[model samples]
Target: MKALKIAKSPDDAIKELLSSLFENQKIKGVFSLFYDQDYFYGLVTDKELFNKLTPTAPVMPANGGKMLSRLTMIEPPAVPIAVVLKPCELRAFYELSKLEQANLENLIFISFVCAGVLSLKEIKNNIEEKVANANQKQGLRECCQLCENFVPENADLILPLIDGDNKTTIFIKTERGEELLQGIENNLVEEDFDSAKLSSIKEERSRYREKTWQNLKTENLGIPGLIDIFGRCINCHACGRACPICYCNLCYFDSADNDSGPRVYEAELERRGALRAPSGTIFYHIGRMIHVSLSCVGCGMCSDVCPVSIPVGTIFTRVAEETQRLFNYVPGRNLEEKIPISTFEIKEFEELGEA
Candidate 1:
């Protein structure tokens, strides 16, 4: 539970600290960040080796909080994988684990206190300047700008970039994390905890969330409201794919058995014929609300991945807050609690009528 600081470059700090977890031929695998495929960043884990990081890596896009949900489905689960993730990713992973979509039995969550990250496009535009002006701050991606969950909620090992200090604040939040850190605890320097600063940061984030939801609600007005809100949707389903709780093996839209493509086209034609696209643009949002509202962690990946720049995460978070409040449930807070729909009492609706 003690906060410890270590002086080292970010990359070197990560490599040195994580190297211990792979010691004594005990580690089976690792899931960490690496550059692969067309993506500049991705999650890679070893399915084959135990002693070293795997050379044959399966990398996907570092699309904020989507990787952990997919990690649940990895065949022949990789145990003791050192997953390098952001705070939102950790929160999403915890929520998914609570919903049974993710199994974190042997996963080591190594999270960063993110200031935010730059998109590839932004990186390209200011490549020369970005290289020169290492201190510049405004060139970050839109998703990173809106992100409020900078401090991790469920990370086993937290790496914080405290107050412009390039070194990391290595803190353990779980028994598993403590066990892992025991090996390198001697190298850590004890520091006075900043309770006030931490609280201020959290308060600022909460205010940002409130302001965002208020604006989103004000913007979404009426019947043409839904259309105007999602008018540019090309039906790509990127939001669904980015969602950590949307864990269907073969989704209806993705399945060959469903005539969803044709159905969507026909619905569009009907819209051209003066019929509204009844829940057409918002079907995924509606379907997800019904499916995983209880488990939604509000990581904002849905909005982050939307090509049309819709505020999908803000809408979901607003709805999820109300839904969770109604059910008296907080997702990812505890693993043992039953999901709302899964729990029912015979006397619960006794006042409604004679059953």
Candidate 2:
């Protein structure tokens, strides 16, 4: 739990640190987490050549965590991988670890303080113009704006942009992270941060969250209001795809043989009443609530990816806070703590009375 500052020159510090990671082969591959065009992409690092290349491709948020899960199944084993992820991604990975779908032993998690990311269209219209005008449009991504996970959890290294400089304030949160930084400590200068300043920063973040939640609650006042909050959703599942925690090999929606079958169409034709074509926005959200509410880390990426701009993360966090409080669980705070759902007690639900 040591806090340190990179050298005065931020980019130089980043390059030096990355080069060292490459030199030791501590990083088998580097995954650059950035926003490009209008979506989030993970660019794999070329360790052999020490070059960072966006391989003939890019993966959206849908493929991000799921791809990591599939990597665990590779035979002969793959090299230890380095991934730059948000808090939600880490939380998703944590959840997957619990499900036995993924292993975190050979991975290095690097996380950056995210402000918020913008949509693809919004990026093209807004950020692209700014970056193009500045002649720096080469490797940028569009989803960096609306990203709200400024501080990630369970990361080996945490990078935050502070002051006018991109000087990444690197904090070692784990023993592995401390060991990695130990090798590069000589290259960096240590600086004691002002306790008051850190407190102020936290307070500011809290204020932002307070306002965000207030606005969302005000916008969705009641049941009808809540329905209206997601009324514009076309059930595209874009929100699910964008969510780093919504990891399922095969989703229920992927099924072609729905139980309703012909009755669904018959009922629709019988009355002028319209059946919500892509039903289950409410159900999808509720299911997620029940599934991950105890582990929600408030990354805010879910709301960022919603097409209609529903504040899904806010609602999830608001509910998750209550859920975690009830169970006395805080995801990612300590890896040793057992997940609430994973353990049970005979007397836990005794209040329900004997059957």
Q: Best-fitting candidate, measured by lDDT? A: 1
Kindly list the per-residue Cα lDDT of model 1 for residues 187-283, writing each as its tens digit. Answer: 5554554556666656656676677777778345555676677777777877787777776768876667544566776776787855344334566
CA lDDT of every candidate: 0.61, 0.59
Supply candidate 1's per-residue lDDT for 26: 37
**lDDT per residue as tens, model 2, 263-302:** 8767876885666767656766777778767877665557
Residue 189 alpha-carbon offset, candidate 1, angstroms = 5.4
- The positional error of residue 327 in candidate 1, measured at the CA in angstroms, is 2.2
Stretches > 4 Å off in candidate 2 = 1-5, 8-12, 34-40, 43-67, 73-77, 126-149, 163-169, 181-195, 218-222, 256-259, 264-274, 353-355
How high a TM-score does candidate 2 get?
A: 0.75
Please give each candidate's TM-score: 0.76, 0.75
lDDT of 1 at 261: 68
